[model samples]
Target: MPSRWLLSILTLILASAIVVACNGDNENTETSGKETDGGKPDDFVTLKMIMPGDESARMREFVDNELNDRLKNDLNMKLELTYIPWGSYQQKLELSLSTGEDYDLFWHGTPFVSGYKSKGYIQPLDELLQKYGQNLIKNIPAENFKLDQIDGKQWAIPSQAFTSAGKFTSVMVRQDLLESVGMTEIRTIADLEAFYRKMHAIDPSYYGYLETDRGHEVLWRELSGENLTAFDERNLFAVNEDTGELVNYVESDLYKKVAHLREDWVKKGIIDKNLVGNPQSKIDQENAGKLLFRVGAVSRAMENLQTAQKADSGAKLREYFLAPDKPRYIVAPSNEAYMIPAAAKHAERAMMFMNWILKSKDNYNFIIFGVEGKYYRIENGKIKLLTNDQLMYEWMWRNKNYFTAPTNVPDDVVRDMLHNDDNAKISRLFGFHFNEEPVKKEMAQVLTVYKEKFDLINSGLVGYNSGFSSAMTALKKAGYDKVFAELKKQFNEFNAGRP
Candidate 1:
């Protein structure tokens, strides 16, 4: 309670800081009204974008003093980016979209665009692309654009900038703990459980034996060796890649297998019963050198290793890919995106600005890596990032063609990240967009049920037998059948139509 209270206090302070900084920037928008080539200043459009993360005076200065100054001359457009702390991002994002006060568009994260589209907060970008985003269509592959499309209409610019070679889940274990247990590697579920047991015996005070930021069902599916693609996220619904059958993943035996495994780990004192929401808890513990394991993808492990080293210089962590025998699937380039609000006052300018960013490799790289000398520099053909925080929200604009890895990164990472999605298990539904429009209310209610009942079950706090049945019953009452039916119908048609 005390920690939550303190967090709440900090959230308010950060929110207030963001508001104050935004106000100052708004009053300081002298550059947003820069003159055009023919001396028409009205041609300049200032696109307002809302983002997540705390206010950074450094970033504000870089955008206004440097980035915007260049944009005023080249594209005749400017950007007004506002930050809302992660704690209050969704709430504030929805509020801004609902009100349309000082907001043109905002970041659209995965598993969220569906909800936003259902609520009519964001608009279709089909016409916008035809008119102003032509450069985007020319540069970005058609398959990549489908990531942000639903009902065959693009709702936002795709957020993938990596090679999209494919996505596979991996685990990061504390090497110190492994060596302490006289173990070298963990490649099996049995090995994982044994490692946890020995680690718990040494220090039961450690949180959970495993903590993952990735979707639970997807992670477990990889471990279970199931041929299922959780297209709807969090194992709410899935399509069997082999059979093309759509069904409720939660109701499948695969769900029961992993749930029971997690429960067993919990019973054996390997998993913490007091599971917290989100991967941020794991991040917090890792910073304090208390976390035992972290799970996500290969890139996630790489990022985790960097953060762990900063948290503890002596920290020894090793990354291992789960289900190594199976191919990693590429569903989309990335799950990050930015969507234009339907009520955006400058929708055309928003499209033009984004299109301009992708018009050239140099332009894209400049936006991401920042000034060549200050934020980054190339040494021996490799980029050296001087400040990681200069543009912390640069993930939203990742373009594989323009991506340059820092010197600290491994060459294989750079190679894999920049490649096309050909070498890996590309999903049959790679370009298939699931529309929740027909069953919006049902999906919402079922998702609410999932949050309330399934979070604990998925976290391994309780055995599947203890609560899984009741949750299924609740889901059925919440119209899970309708969702499943709709998904099945769509997947069948999509699969049949695919070449």
Candidate 2:
């Protein structure tokens, strides 16, 4: 009887051990599942973000303390931001990607999308986005997603604000000068020319038009109504309005006319002769009250005027939209995008961050506008300036949905500029992306020629006819014909697939 009782006791002990082992296995499985599927790991993770422009020390502290705490509570992640100045951003980004640095997300422009995708540095976010970025998908328009796609795969998340409809360039003239010249309004290019002449007559010391070298292209696009779309690194080929054929922009008659006009302005001393490669000079002159006229997008006119007024309180600015009579809206693809590198250790988290930015107004405003009460205040649904704590290049991440008007400008004016679609004119090739792989070499060579020859012509350093002719010859010699053919083939394929 004693032996039998001992046997029973041992058997019961063995059974209890089995049950304990099974429970341990279940717990291990659950923990593993949590780690692999969206749940936080035992150790915290840090996401490294690279962006353009310098963030103030105050801003950094706020982000690290306040923003990081919030992200940690919500995502179990912290953000480490690195700001590269605008001029050095591209080079630094390239080096970082090439070296396989331990970075997560970065700001990028549309031009580099294809190159980055082809190099395998960036990953397609279709699956991750669908899984984690539902808010992003919902907020951004379908057309915008199409713009960021290449070969039917999305490579980046485009900012939801001002995706395409903000291309409103106008001639900005000093109101005080306009009145001084007896001109209340400038209705046409001829009227602009007359104003420039009058302003030059009034104050020959002041530059009539303080436009930069790149402003030449802006003027050309405004006058011709034919947008210059880049085909390769070196060439801009615009679609012929009448024939629907692509033509080299520099060789076109319209380009020649604009060049001639530029030369005439230079001869008449209506434009600053020393404006080439000196873009800062325009800003300096405007602030010093030495510029009578300038050309830029209307959205920035008020801001520019406000800044100018700081230097000279009497300074007042007004905008005259080019071709007001025609009044057509020009739409292009979104140029700004946020991309995640394929080598990122935390891509899902990055997607989560993007989702947060798109969906939450607080998150978006924090990243864009800085600490609200410190940088700006909200009164009557308008944003009032408190301190210039704003990032110098805030537009880099501007989301239109959450954008607030500055106190200096009327809220209605800002709202109208972004949303008014009464005369909206969408481009036929609005979503079209030029694939430059086949003609990349030719494109490079053509771009070299442009830098050498076209800059001289546009800056009025060389005579119009000779400079235009020389640029055309140089382009043709650099295998422009091949580039054009490649662009035509790819454009045809793209057009055929358009729905």
lDDT of 1 by residue, 1-499 (tens): 1245434533553343333323321111123443322232457778788888766666887898788987787767788988887767888888888776757767867667777877878877665566556567666655566566665456677755565433535566776678888998767667676777777788876654565224353356455556666664556776666666775678888778777767776777666655456545544677676676756444554445455666665656665555656555666666777788877877666766777778777777677667888878898877777764645445566665665566766665555444423345655566566778899899889988988888788777767988998988998999989988988788788778643
Which runs in model 2 stand beyond 4 Å of their true positions? 1-43, 166-169, 172-182, 194-217, 221-235, 241-243, 268-270, 279-295, 302-319, 327-330, 392-394
TM for every model, in the order presented, reads 0.81, 0.80
Cα lDDT of candidate 1 equals 0.66
Error of 1 at 347 (Å): 1.4
Superposition TM-score, candidate 1 onto the true structure: 0.81
TM-score of candidate 2 against the unseen true structure: 0.80
Cα error of candidate 1 at position 466, Å:
1.9
For residue 52, give model 2's deviation from the true position in Å.
2.5
lDDT of 2 by residue, 168-245 (tens): 345667776778788887667777777777877766777777353435434654567664433322335665433456
True-vs-predicted CA distance for residue 98, candidate 2, Å? 4.0
Q: Candidate 1, 202: how far from true, in Å?
A: 6.6
In terms of lDDT, the poorest run of 10 residues in model 2 is 24-33
Clash pairs (backbone) in predicted model 1? 161-398, 163-417
